[model samples]
Target: MIFVVTPKIPHFLHFTYGSRPSFSSIHSKNSATSLASTLKSISSSPSLISHGQQLHCFILKSGLNFDVFIQNSLINMYSKTGMFSCARSIFESSPTLDCASFNIIISGYLKNGRLGDAYKLFEKMPLRDCISYTTMIIGFAQNECYEDALALFREMRLLGVVPNEVTMQSVLPAYARADGTRINAMLLHGLVAKLGLDMNVVAWNVMLNGYVKGGLVDLARDLFDEIPGKSTYSWSTMIGGYLQVGRLVEALALYCEMRRTDSRPNEVMLIHIVSTCAQATRLLEGRQCHALALKMGMNFHDFMQATLIHLYAACQQVELAYLLFQEGTKDDIPCWNALIAGLMRNGIVNEAARLFSIMPQRNVLSWSSMISGYAQNGKHRLAIEVFHEMVGKGFKPDETTMVSVFSAISGLCALKEGRWAHQFIRCNSIPINDKLSTAIIGMYAKCGSIDSALEVFDQIRDKARIVNPWNAIIYGLAMHGKAEASLRIFADLQSRKIKPDSITLYGILSACCHAGLVEEGKSHFRSMTAEYGLEPNHKHYRCMVDLLGRAGRLNEAEELVQNMPMEADAVTWSTLLAACKMYENIDVGERAARNLARVEPSYGPGRIALSNLYADAGRWNDAFLVRRAMHNENLARSLDCGVSRLCNALDLT
Candidate 1:
């Protein structure tokens, strides 16, 4: 029942022996030849595993079971089809196996993402040959098991296996992914020189990428210069290395040099340079490349077209990007995703949504792009809606998708939606690390759920995650009338040698002012200037003024404001004026109002505070005069509702 497809040959065949010399004999020869040809074709076509199996049956029936070529091909075909059980059976049953057979099986397993199967076959291979070892090493490296790959390479050396060009090519990439230290990379460089494997392009590329990725761009260029008989890959590697590290000018220069050398730019070179131009936001440079691509007649390739979309989007040329997208002949899903993302980048949310809705095929990237676009445009509701639709379509979101969704929920302050995302993440066993966990805490804090924020903060064992989570907890506690607790946390941060940033100091100072801890507030203000060497900014000065004002020490607060090195703006003077009104200190209130009017001539709060002081002092005519001035200036103060809540809760006694 086994059948293999091969090229049709006319009137060719083989026979058992000289049985007869008739038409049947001629036809039989042709049939046998066709069958053999078919077997050869099936062996190479990775998609014909089922047909290759049928050919295997024919080989068995025709007594060609001992044919080494036939057996090796069967093993390779089965591995390609992910029929590892069948490949194993053929491999074990075959009395003889060569390095080629082992390599084929290992490569196939690696391609199929079956690392365990690759390792098992590698273990069973005889001779511990270099090809076999290199194949498995590459498998481990590609699978991102970098540490294991390095361990295996070391074991290869312990077995007295001399490292060859193939060995260096396969194992050097593992070092790059591991972010191996400069010393470690230098050690590998020495090994390459000692082994005389400099001509190994893969090893050299890996090392170059390592240095570029590690911000050792100078070192990478030095190595590139030393490379003898540079190939197109060498030039492309340098271009990409420079591009990766944001050296757009260097990458472009290298690309020009590559062209001058008559090296034909490939898809990789085009994508790398175009991406760099996009990042640089150089619209003019990108247009030249677009013209060059058209001249080179590579405008139709999917990768090149995708880069064009990205380039136009990044340059903020939405109209031009749209025109290019409309003219695109190819309708690949990636092309559509790129265009939609471009539209989103330009703040054309409606256009992006339209394109997203009509996309013929939507993958995770496409779905995530739409969701992120909605979130970026402050349309979180639509973002959540699209995410739900994506999930309904059975598209499982990855970590990137989760991060976007987390951001959307936080932006909308939709804790209920955030809970759903959390549930999905938990059910899927996604690790709640700093990025996602911090977003969750931030969402709760924004929604006025300090208790929830604290609960999440407590669960985090690493204080070095970010200063943000600490800022959230401290500010939330201070706002919720827990100044003592907030101050304790701030002290703890100092005790642990965690240098508090401006936000940290501001939050703690505000808490002290609200709690009427004048001494504690003064202590912090002095420490901030004298101990931490942090120059008191306007915010810090304002907090200090508020501290004295709330403690009914109006004279001291007025003196602080008067002596501020920088000009006291409306906010600083307004705080002092509000404090004066609260304590009914008319003299200081008038002085603060005069200072405020000079800084903020059109400020409604300044006029209003002055009017309030006049009304309290029974100066009806003066109050009316300030009101007329406010009316003439057309300065209106829309009371900030959030700040109103804070002020209402404050006990200014």
Candidate 2:
């Protein structure tokens, strides 16, 4: 707001006044005392801007305002109080500025997430050092401007500045965040190697994590082996890596090695191992780890407790899962869901329902767990009841519950119940997508209604959803004595570019044997191996034997059994024995029965088929001995006796 004055007249007036009356030295002491008092008062009430303005006027009157300590104190007070404009004024007015002063303002701006202002001040600073650059880069990365962070790092390097380990550690994860086949990750690792930053344990862990998250497990392992010494994080990364790829046994071994090496497994490592144990279903190992975690005093952590609940449930130790659930202090929704799911998994649906009802809070997962438990337990009515409650409570069902409930109703063969559920789904406009339709088809098939099942099957055209439905429909048709219809379904599945699984082939092959279509069955079996790349397991081989045996080709069936790469299980040998019964080949039947007995002496189906073969051959003594052996083994013969039928009579009123 000042204007320029004529220099000659101003200089003449200033010289005359300055020479005539110099102020007494006594005034200097008063000025000094006043400025000191003012600085002290401002410092005490520094937060008040109005007081600061009055103090500014007093300092201008005292003419002792340039005290560096006072200026710095004012800057600190304003910056601390978030009065950046006032803080910047004090900073700009200072004639003597040091790195410390610059750092204070820069840190203030950075802390407030005002990176633009921070960068501007950083550029204007006369001194650029490691701490300055580190602060800026950290702010950039923290703000998620990773590219800018890297660019600043490059700028630091070009200035012939050597970055310290902290510098490398801050920016390394930025490369991980940028995606290009993980090239940035690899480049960063190479930079670390070239810079010899391995002595920095933090840097090494970051690189190890980069490799892990980038899916370079081999590279991660290589880096792991080369580490001068590994820490808990290093062990966790490797263990987690093995786990991510389902190499559960390897993960276990590493955990053991880690324990042997005396690396104190912290809470995180324990959680990872617990999850791995759950996946591996190693209940005993999980218990051991649980004990270790308790000894280590990490038992109170909510994450560990949740994992313990899941592990116990997966091991089918629902009692232990409940015990943990009871002891847990933090009962999150997931914790409740895990306990409920565990109970359901162990077929303790009644207990699951009890727990679910008492849950303080219920989300979709809790409801789904209860529904799934009832459905799997063949309590289809209860499952549907839960679904209705879910809808009535305004909790919309998810896909998992839909699929699970549909499957349960189908398994129970409750045709009326299934139809009612179907109608409800339709009225509510629930998607009758591939999964729902497949479940319906499975339901009809279970009820021995092939035509209705096939009608539902015809509607699914999506290849992804078609294959599974086709497999279900085929199995249903084959079990109902309509083998030809099963084979035809399989053919249609194959024609639509939807590859069938061994299960589909298993059904079709059995159907082919039942219908005496040996050639077609053989062709389909071959296609399973050649086209689908499916290894013919014992089930497939058993179906092949049935296919051959039904055609009166006993020798081919025997050859198929003998040529099995693995030992034929009870089902495989039993299928061959059944063929012997149908073809009346007593000698082969006896051999199959003996093999079957060796495989599983107590299986009722095998024992009955063998005993009947001896009876049909008039080997009454052998048949009596077989029955005696069965009785001695305490294997009861399943009563395939006639089941009484109920006749429904309609009365016209």
Candidate 3:
């Protein structure tokens, strides 16, 4: 005989056995309670399948095979063992199923990253509970399906499912990941308040983190202040929030406050504080943090060492960074890369190269840093060589690496390499973000391919609606002597409400100079300070001097150079001298030449310009004297190149 009892609970079934005869007497001797206990014990064992199979066989033989209790245990064991198919097979083989069975299979699908299957099983469920909804919501959040997570949260609320703390925790982070979800975050905060969970520290921290990530630091700070008993995570989140918005002073102040409190600083807090110091350029504060780390015995830790290296490097103390790098373990890649990048930033290329050669391991960052460093420091050939070497080493280049390579190609005016990079980007389906698009435009422009540059500019115009590509296009057009087109682009930029920075004004002024638009250049120069609030830097001053000098306003150019707030550089003097040579103005030309020679005695181009100015005026003796000075300075080769350029400019070959 057999007996079955249906419990008052919604989804639980209990089975019991009475005396049985013949083959069914195997487990009939043992009670159902004892058998269920045995099955649970088997589920906990290390080798689940072997023990579970024995239990299943005994259940079948003992005539208690259809017990829901035993079947549920089997599903759990299979799921735990990562045998989802077996769990599903058991669920399907069962004649009766409940919410518990569906929940097990759905969770198994989620665990195995089979979200589609999980959702499918969930949709087919005859009954759903809080656990079912919460599981799916958490799964969506974990997978970065934030919209789906929030949508489900709303639906859960609509269906009168009162969410517990876990549901709120799962859904809050989804809002934090996106900027447009701030309103949703605030609404959730209100819901938490209505649910009387606002006082909960975990809830408070989640809300604070969401606000911080949404770029609402003030709101985050307000909420943070309301938390009576803040946790370490709360303090760190606030500090990181301030740091994210570049409120370095507030971040430091908060750190100081955190130190005064009973809560001790942890690794996460220390890392953020060190970063704050670096951003604020507070070397003294950074040293204090370093001392604290040492006192806490975290100095030699790989992550702490990397942060310290970055801090010292940002403070322009490369030697300190190097010392830390050398003192730390050699196997840490981040430490090595930080030191290498620091050396490169300080223009210590040879040392950086030496370190790169001996790096225990190299990643994309190492190669990208080396390539970018060489390109920025004007070692374009070496940069290109390193890029090709990185490719040869089978390291796939990311966007940053490609950007550096394109910049180097631009510097060398290597059209072939530039074309190949563009093709590679397309073939690899690399997203043409604004930075890469600007780099591509610059490469084409600098390589004397204005049409190609313009074409790229038009292609990315709709998507890359930023100032960088505009600057690149305008500068390229200016370089190619399309002054009108450059100005037209500048006008369009203003019409689009895209404010021009100093680089944009410089490009405009340069276009004016190239097109001999003196009055236009003067007006734009004045507007740089008045309209755009951009004070004329040295480059702007040089452009103005060149403009005035080229228009034969020699006296005004000289006066402008003399009265300029900043000291004129060698390029400024050279530009005036070149203009004088073009116009054969010996009086002002001699003054400009004298200044140029004094400022850059070794600069062969200036000397050649002065010589050509004399030659144009038939001053053969003076021209010969300039050549003799070039010989005296051992700049004969540079003089030869300069003379060739001068001859082409003056039609005097």
Candidate 4:
């Protein structure tokens, strides 16, 4: 039998209310019914608190104040109006109460962010139900107290209280938020299926969110297909999952399928899709999302507007990006940051600065964008200047800002500044995670401190698990002509069972080139496709050509170029031609020069190298012809390709 305590409000009110206004006549049934209706309506609108107060006065006079229902309504009214002191006073004074009386005050505490109070009241509750458990669970989950929420769920299960749809919805997200709880999610799924909530779309969506967040995209897709009635949220969860894991092809395919369905997408989902498109530089899909947003009349808020500006800039449509920024709410900082970041991405550094200087308000992100943008555009000195300015203005630099600052210091090869940044990172106690560790290593390596790079690499706990630190050390060794040391590091990486990525391959190949390791280079080139399933790109092939040419393997180098699936570009031909010139191989050098000219008619380096090769070989006539062609190429093209390319984020230390 459910417990129900008898109320002592009549005795409590004797002292609590003190006195009541004299009623001219007895309260009729119509008056009591009207009062009940008014309280219910007033509960939803906090603005009618004064009107509710007037009703409270009427209650004390009508002798209906003893009613538990009337007291609950009054407590609810005060809670909704953010008058928690009054709500708690009524709750404590009432001796007689039911389950709802506890639930109401508990919900009031929860809505007001008083979890501790809510839990205390719940423990004191004379009776509890599914609502009580679910409310507490949701409250804990909202505050990121996932363990507490899940514990309460277990307690509810142990008490034999059946979970409703609301309970499942709250519990699924709680488990998802907690790390190492994916297994618990499966158990919850079994519970949900047993309870016959399998067809519930909200439950399915929450479960799908769990799978996505757990990095199990394939499992999420499998479950997503099983969902009977897919909602807009379902599609967004799956699409976002794919994007988060960098599965752009899969994300785009799913997006196409979503478009074919009848469900209209929500603004947040569309906004995220647009944002991902910007990061991947997928211009076509980004434009499509923009058009759809316009057609669907999604709210043009600062964030979405900023994302659009970033998208346009990423696509190299600078004018469109500028126009959109001009038309947006200029006062909003996000739109301004987007415009500035876009300019940086497209190598419009000066324009980004101009806009950054004039923005009405500046946040930490605004300062970060400027520092990163300047570094990206090869203005390392300017990047450092902006970083100091940001700190002078009292904006504490976050990890991301420090990453950009270290990058600029690396660019300038300023050992002093790099050391200062390192000291600052330690003083601030920033966690040296994989990305920051990699950046710090790269900075030290490029600043002519290979020993420091190795020290940083050794200090990282995830050095073997992550490829970046290994890459930095190997590249640093190769840069310093410690080719044997670089090779040994690669061997150590293999022994650790660490899978090497493209950057790792580049570092090893460069190491081989520096050490003149013909056999080692050939073995790696073959293993790239044979063992690692990695196809060697143009750069890899260029390194091989330089190695083989330097080692007098001219025929093999020529054959590799000829058999490469992709056409040999200017860099490849230049490498081959340089090798040919070293060995005085006129036949191969001529072939390389002709191909280089065909591919890049305005590349002066290829033509100049060919002329030098001829002049060194005493082929005066051929050298004169090459010089004339270079002169004509220069006259035909006013801008050098090299200069144009370097202006757009191509600087290296």
Task: Give lDDT per model, in order.
Answer: 0.74, 0.73, 0.80, 0.79
Could you tell which candidate, 2 or 3, scores higher by lDDT?
3
Instruction: For candidate 2, give the lDDT of residue 492.
Output: 68
- Candidate RMSDs in Å, in order, are 11.6, 16.7, 11.2, 12.4
Residue-level lDDT of model 4, residues 462-535, one tens digit each, is 44457887888888899899999899988988886467887888888899999999999999888888888898
lDDT of 3 by residue, 95-125 (tens): 9887878877888888899898888888898
Backbone clashes counted, model 4: 1
How high is the lDDT of residue 247 in model 4? 84
| TM-score of each model, paired residue for residue | 0.54, 0.54, 0.60, 0.64
RMSD of 4: 12.4
Using TM-score, give the best candidate's number. 4
Q: How well is each residue in 161-198 modelled by candidate 2, as lDDT tens digits? A: 77767677767655554442346656766777787764
User: After superposing candidate 4, which stretches have Cα over 4 Å from the reference?
Assistant: 1-220, 228-233, 244-264, 461-466, 495-498, 607-653
For model 1 the TM-score comes to 0.54
lDDT of 4 at 631: 60
Clashes found in each candidate (C-alpha, N, C closer than 3 A)? 5, 0, 0, 1
| Two-way TM-score contest, 1 vs 4, winner | 4
lDDT of 1 by residue, 1-653 (tens): 02243454223222223232233443355354444454455455555555566556766776666766666666765765667778778877788888777777777777778899889878887767777778788788776677888999889889988777767766665776654565766787688788766455555776566556545676678777766667787788788788777878788788888888856778778877887798789888788888889988988778788889889898888777777777785468888888898888889888888888787888999999998888888888888898999999999887777778878887888877877787898898877766667677777777677788778888873544457667767887887888998998787777753567777888888899889999988888888768777788899899999889988899999999898889888899999998888888888887787676567655567667767877888878767776665555555764311122112222111
Q: Which pairs, if any, clash in model 4?
A: 7-96
**Which regions in candidate 2 have their CA more than 4 angstroms from the true location?**
1-245, 249-276, 284-304, 392-394, 429-437, 449-452, 455-459, 463-467, 480-499, 526-533, 603-653
Poorest stretch of ten by lDDT in candidate 3: 1-10
